[model samples]
Target chain A: MFIDGRALPAGTALEADIAIVGAGAAGITLARALKDSGLSVALIESGGLEWSEEAQDLAAGELGPQTYATPDTVRLRYFGGTTGHWGGWCRELDAIDFEPRDFVPLSGWPLKKAEIDPWYAKAQSVLQLGSPQRYADSEGIAKAAGAALPVARGGDIEPILFEFSPPTRMGEVYRAELEQSAVKTYLNTTLVDLRVGDDTRTVTTLTLARDGGPALAMTARHVVLATGALSNAQMLLAADSQVQGGLGNGADQVGRYFTDHPILIGYAAILALDPSAGGPFAFGDIAADKRRWRLAFQPSEAYRAAQKRLSCLITIEPPGPRFDPAAGAFDRSDAKWFGAPETVNALAAANATGPVRLHVLNAGIETRPNPDSRVTLTGKRDRFGMRRLKVDWRLSDADLEHYLLNLGDFAKALAHSGTALLRIPPDAAARWPEETSWGHHNLGTTRMGDDPRTSVCDRDGRVHGMANLWVAGSSLWTTPGAANPTLTIVALALRLADRLKAEMAA
Target chain B: MSDPVARAWAVTRRTFGATLLGALGLAAVETWPRWAFWRGAASSLDALAGLPQAAALKALGRQAQAAMAIPAGYADTLAARLGDEGYAGAVARDRAEGRLVSIDGWLVPETQALAGLWLASAG
Candidate 1:
């Protein structure tokens, strides 16, 4: 049942069979999965049922050389976490995402996509995305949507599908189940410190702080950190008093390899002759079976292998302003014409005799795992005296180059198919990060791997060298694919839930 | 030089000036199979010819020809048999075959880029 952690008297020592920290997508999934396992579970959340300004301010942190959404602004501190504002785009990671690619450094996960396929099926329902089977049946999905997949003839680029959620807000959808379950749910409780035994391997006690209440502690047979990517790293890196670098920092790997899918908003435009309105090839999202669907293009496996390019998901947007190069000399300033919608159609319209303008293209590209792009502690501290995080989210030069190359090839593939003409911005390279935005899907700080020297967690989500302590959420990702991360985050959480149940039973 | 294409080029240079003429004469001699399409007055083709993208468009046309394995004199064959509108049909065909090139960063069929080059030089 829900218990306001703040109402608990000073120095209350709560005990449970399992203590799960930060009740977001990952934590809530675990709590729900283990709700009836007969193990007493303590689910602690920093914010109460609603938004609180004080709680949100605790997430404020500094930025790096590149400009990013400030921590507090990009993330929600209350229940449901960032899902409270997510767009609900969901796609499973490609098989290649789990393999070690020679082109990508620190790439590949210890577990293959197949290892968690069952969990993904379960996660589909948990995410409110119907029928896990539909994701694999491409032709059926296209038939059901009543639209032909773009470039259906086949090329270096092929259409990939994304299933939309009613965007199941976990906090609200499961609030009743949580309330009815046997678990002890602590709201408005922030984990402050982790006390380890003399060996510094097992987390013995967890100290939590409430805004208006005195300090409280929780001891559990097993401890799980499911506080999203940035916060998981922040919490782990902050608990350095007992173990020097942090609880899982024996390899100095905690807070390293942070990543987000870098998106190119309006880098190119497409001109087609009277594109089918609301079709898969047309710009805009489509709906079928009471669910919204979006069709985006990705490089085929052959294309990536042959070109050594990174993965990217390219979507077409409706036509807007016309950047007419036909009217005058195509000057450098005309580069601004990109992202201008009507240019594609205007160009097509200008040709009067045939071919009409189509749409603009937006691409969200993947970045390689670079240790230099990481999260670190700043001297500034929050109200709880915990050092605020400094996010240094970096994208290497090759990352942008690879994305543009993949885009150019995709444009060629479209033309080859007699579908449309794509106009890539001439100055795309010059604009770099200035023209790029992020997925806001923070990932890969406490990555899972077999090597403690390189990763903070093992294949089972257990922090390296630490017993009975586990790290959850996207923070456990070894590589961030171009796919939006929530589905995978939930899938992995379910997988971990099964493992945790077995461990407790043993 | 007495060919109608030469006559059209004369009009084009006079209309748009010589500096922007670029390699129009050389491009025409090497790539244009038949210059009959230049029989009209200096049209919108003249404007495109004067743009900075004209050079790259010519180069892309040549690259497209090589990539698509189109005969060197195929342009003349199409123009001779199909007339001025033949290039547009060829662009559609080239697009269907996936024979494309990037000119000024705009992805266009190889035949389209070649036609742009031909028009720039044909006039």
Candidate 2:
């Protein structure tokens, strides 16, 4: 049963097999997966079903130091978590995302892409995305985008597609299943503390609050935190009783290794191919990988490297006389002409046509993993008196260097391929000398790895020090790649659920 | 529960007055996307009713975009960086920010503007 954060029940303690916190993408996915099982689960969320201004504001970068999904970015803080506001783009973590890179320090996942492949298929089925397990579908997508994308010899590229589900709301999707289960969802019952034993070995109980009421202590055999990247480590460090620094903080790595795919509107232009919109193209088209998807682009090696993902979307050109959809230029969409996306589109169009007949889509660059810029709990408490998260987030210099290098190098490659042109390459170069940053994708606080010393959680997401505790969501992403991370988060939660189920069975 | 000090100082009244305009603005925004579509649909329907032939589309486009405007969020964020004030200003700034392609002027901007005009005209 759900409880309000401001109103506490008369009871002193509640018991459950699994005490899960924050029903975002990670929490909700795991909860739903474990719903049918008879094991008791108490799913807690700080926000109610609908939009709350306070909760939304808390998600914003302007209000908080950590910013992935802001008030404007997501309709978060509900049962479904952040999925309500997702654009429905789904892709598996690249096989390379698991490997350690000599170039990128502190990069690599202990688990590999092979282990995740089965999970990806399961995730695809759950998301109801079309099949993407084959190359024929990818070829179909390449054809859909038009004949410009060069077919590779090595089969080096992975074809990832966007799935627009009836907007997967984690809460609503799992609501019916959860109602009949042993799992009890506690909405507005915020977790205040994750107390551990005297030896800081196991999680004893979680101190939770119902809005303005006195805290309730709940004991559980296991506890998992899926409260996003910023909030995950925030809660860990806030549990001051167990360790001086935080839970699973034996290495003082509670809030280190933060990374995100920082996006930039790179060179954009007018394609020479006139757009015939009605024929074979729609923003919502189907690709062969059993995934219904849209236009795709090949990100650069420097950009789409291990732990780095750059999802470059090539949108339909703006419907105008001189716009060329085939050449990656000339968009008449509002993005090019009206709002922010439109404005960027317009910039691309102008750059692609006239004296310069080329527009390159924005490069969504991934940053180097930096352990210094991270999140921690400030002594100051939130509505629950749990230490509110104090986040210090920033893009690193390596991020900028690679961003520029990849952009330049890719522009050169496209020019060499005779598939692209830079209207004013020198000008594009000049403008990039000064660095600017934006916050949308926050990642890597409680990063995942086998070693307890460097990472907060084990490969399966169990907290290193506490066997019963696990970290979920983007917080567990040791390094974020170039794609939007929502899909990856869902995939990770699904994996964690299997482990949880097996453990309970044992 | 009203705070005694705030009540005594008439803060509630003042705060309410201050937010009155913002509330209206939000209401306008909430309805704008739908409104745009509504006007667009109405114009197209009217065109089909009035002139079922050549210019039905052309007529519909104009009606929808009669009051077409960009959201203030863009103006506050990307536009300011690019040096734009409003919708037209934002587009103009966006075009200006790009490297000059036309020997004298960029043709794509005009084409984009025409497209916007078309989308708006359908209203």
- Considering every candidate listed, which one attains the maximal DockQ? 1
The C-alpha lDDT values of all candidates are 0.77, 0.58
Chain A TM-scores, candidates in order = 0.93, 0.81
Per-prediction share of native contacts kept = 0.46, 0.00
Regions more than 4 Å wrong, model 2: A1-8, A54-75, A134-136, A144-160, A267-291, A299-360, A416-419, A423-439, B1-123
lDDT: worst 10-residue window of model 2 chain A: A272-281
lDDT of each residue in A124-199, candidate 2, tens digit only: 6566565546322555565655533432322223233445555577677776767666677887677778878776
Task: Give me the displacement of residue A70 in model 1, in angstroms.
Answer: 1.1
Q: After superposition, how far is residue A393 of candidate 1 from its true place, in Å?
A: 0.6
Give the count of colliding residue pairs in each prediction.
13, 58
DockQ of 2: 0.01
Residue-wise C-alpha lDDT for candidate 2, range B8-113, written one tens digit per residue: 6698788887899889887885555333223434432232222211131222223223424533342134323322232333334444554212211112232233
Q: For model 1, how does the per-residue alpha-carbon lDDT over A274-313 read when each residue is reduced to its tens digit?
A: 3343355544666776777777888886778778889999
In lDDT terms, how accurate is model 1? 0.77
